[model samples]
Target chain A: MKNIVKIEQLELASAVVELGKKVGAGLAAIGLTGAGAGVGIVFAAFILAVGMNPNLRGELFKLAMLGFALSEAVGLLALMMSFLILYS
Target chain B: MKSLFEQFEIDLYCIIITRFFDVSITTITVYLGLLMVIVIGMYKVSLYKATLIGNNNWQHIGEMIYEFVVDLILEQVGKPGILFFPFIMSLFLFVLTLNVMGLIPLSFTVTGQLLVTFTLAITIMIGITIWGFRIHGIKFLNIFVPSGIEPWLLPLLVFIEIMSYVLRPISLAVRLFANMLAGHLLIHIIGVAAIYLMQFYFIGILPWICVIAFMFLELGIAFLQAYVFVLLTLIYIANIINLH
Candidate 1:
């Protein structure tokens, strides 16, 4: 459905490489959508927990943080992969 | 000025020629060395005044941080973790300072570099593994086994546990690296957009507002990520100590 515009400076070989890199990077970025959902769930649960027990907010915040880091780690791994694909 | 991406490059300053080897000094070394100096100097100059209860402004701030970290360790790891107070506190301060310093205009972000974070994570992981073996002996391997698991499913669950355990260091390093890199890159793009839009002179406010909001978010994350790293380190150590 998508097209790569033919540029005068880009030869066939270079174009193929570029196309592959872009595709690979795009695929890697797809992982971010999942990360987005994961982060949303982390904060959502955090808020829900705080709402349930107002006094437990302090303890819950730390748990939320650990959860955030774990979920964000998954997403960041994907982002790093994309970065590596594009830059390297 | 270097291009946005080019700023991440590590330019060599000078090479040290010892009798046995040559060590290349670069921007990373400079920043890390500066970070070390700032962390050590800040704590020493502030806390060394009066050991019991110094009334210096920086001393009060340092004590507040010390109390916060102490509470965190006590809450998470309990009595055994008191011995690691200096290490954990220093780790938190070092990362917090590094992340905050990166927010300064035109300064290179040390944590944004994958190699630096990976080295930190790997060293911690290696140390924890060694410490686990030392304390728990063969019992440390019990960490991979769950108490309620079915006998037939033990192998499968253990494999999953071991795999996740091995991935911890990689995840820890990449999380910090990517977060720092993302914050910097987003700020750069927004900044450029804000500047360019100013030529038109009206809509520039939108990007500037976004830039300001993101800066605040970056500040919170600067603290959050450092705390997360230390907290996780403690939890891992706690697991080793309790073999749970």
Candidate 2:
């Protein structure tokens, strides 16, 4: 079992709120792990497509960029959510 | 320990107008100083002829930037995007200046703030939407309504499209804001660690090396984030106008 530090002098309510903020912030950021995988997959596909057909590089790149932006938006949303959980 | 966010804390200098509008003088001063420098730099670069015939030293850099922006617009949005060359160039240069200035030691990163970047994104988005509407009229609604949708799936598809469209500005603003904030925070944290570890004889070197490497990475990111921001903006404009 992990050792848990307890402050005898401090009240329980405030300590709980403090702990909640940290844990909540982290929980919100869990979505980013999936987002990272999504982005990597998108770029990996992009590289494969470009390698196969040099002539399709320009068109493939635009699609890849669009995919990247959409994927990144998910990560940013998660980040903003975590910030909100921490502050509010 | 000063908290990691302590670096982002803004100290109010002398208020410019205290009664109705409480303006922070330091923020204004920094913005105006950067603006003046960018304006002068643009003027100097544009003054000389961009020709390989005569002395082509000073104007070469300007020509290169101009050509790059032009080519990027043409490549992304086709010939129609060339109409937005001036706006795109100015926007890229302005963001680039703010981003590079933030790298200066002891300088505030205004671009890193959500307020600044969100305002820019929202205003541009509003303008682009209005422009699209003006050009395409009610037909612009077609952007949300994909052709040949199943009767039952219409609502679901339209809802998803509208939601994604609404999230565009938020995505654009957050991307740059988070990147810069992370870079600056990393640099500050490493610097602080280096200072604290300096008490040890040999351990300080590792943190110092990290600090230097991170600074170089941050410097590259400063330029790259600006480019990404502009490129995305161009893409949005093309999508809006072309509706493809």
Candidate 3:
């Protein structure tokens, strides 16, 4: 029984590595939530701007899209980091 | 279950012996060849029988793409940007085609590869940087400086400005690569799940339905990413030209 208990302890050490990988991956994915929030903030500002000045829709759209792309890029960077952690 | 990542594996077919080197053909080469033919053939077939005022749908699409690209350039870069029409149009079409090609079942998504997207991005970055230098001389470096800033803040802002400037190409590549990779991986996971679930008779139908919905979403993303890439490219070019 003591030997069996010793083997179980050995298994736990290796299992910790596996658990850490999964835990880190899960933490990395939390960045997607930040991304979601960033995208929401961007679009919310965009909609407010357009609502106030409909005529500026054309110009505002260019800026909005630029803002959207930049924000989305940051989100994707976080995602790629998590992806590298999980897959690599 | 078969590993879905098996779809991304590149298997070498054969190596061709050149005078100086060996060229090994792989899965990407085959798909890239097919993609080239498809894109070129599409333009040829569409415009081959185009009628000016007739209901030629394909021609209309071609023209619409042309007009849209032109409008995008004009809006962002003004008159000067129109010079980049060919380059921008080709960039949009290629990225769009690559994304759509991935949607076809069992095809390799070239855009999903970082090497491909990053090379294109780096090429654009270097080319524009050279272009900026050529047009404005060393003064083009003025781009790293904002107007009417405190001298103390200028040094800090310049460092930040230069850092962001250099990160442009990397951001451009990662946004596309990650978007394509994650999008395809999502679809593949759902598809495999659908297949496995369908083994349970009527219970399988729901996952298959979910698969179809995700397919549509993937298609929308493919187009949207392509447009976003082109839009961002236009903005970058405009910034370079106008230096504002």
Candidate 4:
């Protein structure tokens, strides 16, 4: 009975490692929520700027894309961090 | 269940030249196919002159891609950046082609591997660092130091700047690698789910639909990530050259 009970008990170190991965990845993913909202704000402001002056579309678009890439990079960094925690 | 990473497995061919040099047949075949396409396409394009008259579809695409790369270079690096046109254009095409090629069923994505993307990133980083030093000489070290900074904050800011600068290749490589890896894994997972769900009648259609939707999304991402990679490269190069 004691042997079966010991086998049923979870290994503490492995459990902690598993929990840490989930927590780390979850914390890292919090950045994506911010990123998503940030991206939405970027385009929203972009729309407002373009609406104010249609002629600025090309210039604004270039900046918008650059901004988008930079913002996406941050999100990707978070994703990479989480993957590192999970995999490494 | 099969491992999620099984898609990334590389099997060697029977014809091994040496113990240290086992060739991955899938990677070689994919790259060779890409080279053949580029060579044939370039040859076809070279057959026609840049006439303002009616252009064929292939020539039109070729010119458009060329113009786009030129515009990107100019936008970031201005007139001086035109020197990198060939290198940037070829890099963009090669990475983009490999990414799109990965979309095809039963094909390997070279960029999906860190070894491939990391090497590209490290090589470009080294090349750009050399170019920066060549242009600015000892002043290249000034890249770590921001201009018009307060004396007290300078040390911390410089340290952060140096750390971020050093992390460029890693971030660049990881961005491409993780994006491709996640996209491919998602598609495969959804695909396998759909296959398993086929045991049910009406419910199987849902995952199948998701698989199709994600495939299309992945296709767009393949192009977008390649563009982002090239754009970031141009931005990095411009930062070094302009020193601002």
DockQ of candidates 1 onward, in order?
0.59, 0.27, 0.51, 0.45
lDDT of 2 by residue, A7-27 (tens): 763568688888999999999
Q: Model 2, stretches more than 4 Å misplaced?
A: A1-10, A46-73, B18-24, B42-57
lDDT of 4 by residue, A1-88 (tens): 6555453356876788899888988898787887787778889999999999999999898788667766766776677687778777
Native-vs-model 1 lDDT?
0.87
Error of 3 at A50 (Å): 5.1
Candidate achieving the largest TM-score: 1
Position A29, candidate 2: lDDT = 91
User: How far out, in Å, is residue B199 in model 4?
Assistant: 3.4
Q: For model 2, how does the per-residue alpha-carbon lDDT over B1-244 read when each residue is reduced to its tens digit?
A: 8776765666666667777885666774667577778767765755645433545766766777889899889888998888889999988888888888888888888887888899999988998999899999999988898778789999999999999999889888988888777678779878998999999986748888888899898887777777788899998999988786
lDDT tens string, model 3, B1-244? 7775777778899888899977879887887888789878977877685744555887888888899999989888999998899999999999999999988998889899999999999999999999999999999998999999989889999999999999999888988998888888899888888877877886947897899999998897788889999988888999999887
State in Å the error of residue B28, model 2: 4.8
Q: Model 4 misses residue B74 by how many Å? A: 1.2
Worst 10 residues of 4 chain B by lDDT: B46-55
- Give, for candidate 2 chain B, the lowest lDDT window spanning 10 residues: B46-55
For this target, which candidate reaches the highest lDDT against the unseen true structure?
1
Ranking by lDDT: 1, 3, 4, 2
Where's the lowest-lDDT run of ten residues in candidate 3 chain B?
A: B46-55
lDDT of each: 0.87, 0.82, 0.86, 0.83
Show the colliding residue pairs in model 2.
Answer: none
> Across the candidates, what are chain A's individual TM-scores?
0.84, 0.84, 0.80, 0.80
Chain B TM-score for all candidates, comma-separated: 0.92, 0.89, 0.94, 0.89
Worst 10 residues of 1 chain B by lDDT: B1-10
